[model samples]
Target: MSKAYVFTRNGGPEVEALVDRDMPTPGPGELLVAVRAAGVNPVDWKLRKGYTRPGSVPQPFPTVFGSEAAGVVEAIGPGVGGFAIGDEVFGNPVAGGYAEHTLLPVAVTAHKPAGISFADAAVLPVAAATAYDGVRQLGLAPGATLLVTGAGGGVGSAAVQLAQHAGVRVIGVASASKKAFVESLGAVHVEPGGGLADRVRALAPGGIDAVFDLAGGDTLREAALLLADPAALISAGDKQLVAELGGAPVERARTAAVLVAVAGLVVAGALRTHVTGTYPLSAAGEALRAVEDGHALGKTVIEVTV
Candidate 1:
């Protein structure tokens, strides 16, 4: 039997309880993976707490809660291609990632790179996808300046690295404690308090070429005020704020397309994945709490296997 974390009712992290179940079989166009590591994101908690809308699948009691993970493919469905048993892969499993095994759609799973460990690759699908969408939306050119708020968090950190790789100057807004960490990712760090727009102006003087608002509270509003001419901005957190700023909502399809492109980049060694912490599958609740508590410096993952 495979072990999985499931939420029988919408509530806190405590609602996530582990249960033993039979391993799932892959459908046509699916791959069954023996999960090694599962990436934990804010959305996981959001869904669990009913902060975000539930998916189309009816939430039967004991529904699995995780999505992204890295593992070795134990079996591949008849119609699938480009993968085989024993292949190392990473993907967003639509249902239960916090498990010993899970099934993923063939399109979502990608061959894990030789240089990337399962723990690191597990951090890719959700946070990397969000960061990729932000960068892609801006079409940020070399020498351009990009500002990212909440740079200490997973998606924000990924944005900083991806933007820097594109030859754009990156300015990251984080708390004082996270300044050095953000700087290590090749971004100039700014403290979160004060007139953020004014501080950004003091640094860039000419305004930012693009902005990525991962912290969607007041930071997004500040980003709108500091945009350069013909501004481009992407908000990963709040759709209402995007609409309020007259910015386009970052759609899931666009995010997925960006992730596919970035996955190629990761495979090519053009980008790096940052994993801050790993927990045992039994400690999945603690991992989610770390993400919810907003203290994690990078992606937090649950290690389901050695």
Candidate 2:
């Protein structure tokens, strides 16, 4: 039996429990992985509260609570190609990642690079990949100034670093507590809340070339005013608000090729995963709480002991 941290029903943390179940068998084009690490994100707890991604199939009771993981391949399903038993890999999971084992679709999975740790690789599939997609979608050139909201969280931090690496000047908006942390990613730090647009204008008088928003609602609305062309505004946080402001949601290329590219960037030292905390599988709830609390500095990952 494989042990998994799961939510028995849609609710709050009270619905969560650790239980044992039979290991899953991979379907065609899937791989059964012995999970070594799982990345925690805000979406995990949100899902427990019954949040569903657009077009996602409804999951049943006792659902696992993670989106990405890294581990060794234990069994390969029929019709899968280019992967072998015992090969290290990481990607978005089939059901959930907070378990001793899970299934990974070959289409979104990628081989783990030797230079990247399982904990770091575990996070790339979600946060880093989203950053890549958002940055590329904005298509800002070097010397261009970009503003990133919620710059202290996983996706925001990665987005700041990626923009800086591309030679784009970045102004990062986060809490006052994260000032140093945001500036460490090569961005000028501006605390969020009241007069946000005025503070950002203080940093870039010529106006921001683009806005990469990870904080939605009021924060997004404030940043939207900074852009001359609303087409330069893109968001991963509030899609509906973005559209209402005449901006588009960040276009995601959820492909293994994209995963491979992000991993290569990590290996090449152009991007840092910056995983700030790790918890054992037994402490998965604590890990989720760290992210769900909205105070986590970088990325939080659950390291599963074999």
For all predictions, the C-alpha RMSD in Å is 2.2, 0.7
lDDT by residue (tens digit), candidate 2, 88-108: 999999999999999999999
Per-candidate Cα lDDT values, in order, are: 0.82, 0.94
lDDT: which candidate is best?
A: 2
Worst 10 residues of 1 by lDDT: 250-259
- RMSD in angstroms between candidate 2 and the native structure over all alpha carbons: 0.7
Question: Clashes in each model (backbone N, CA, C under 3 Å)?
Answer: 0, 0
Clashes of 2: 0
Instruction: Flag clash pairs in model 2.
Output: none
Off by over 4 Å in 2: none
TM-score, per-candidate, Cα-based: 0.92, 0.99
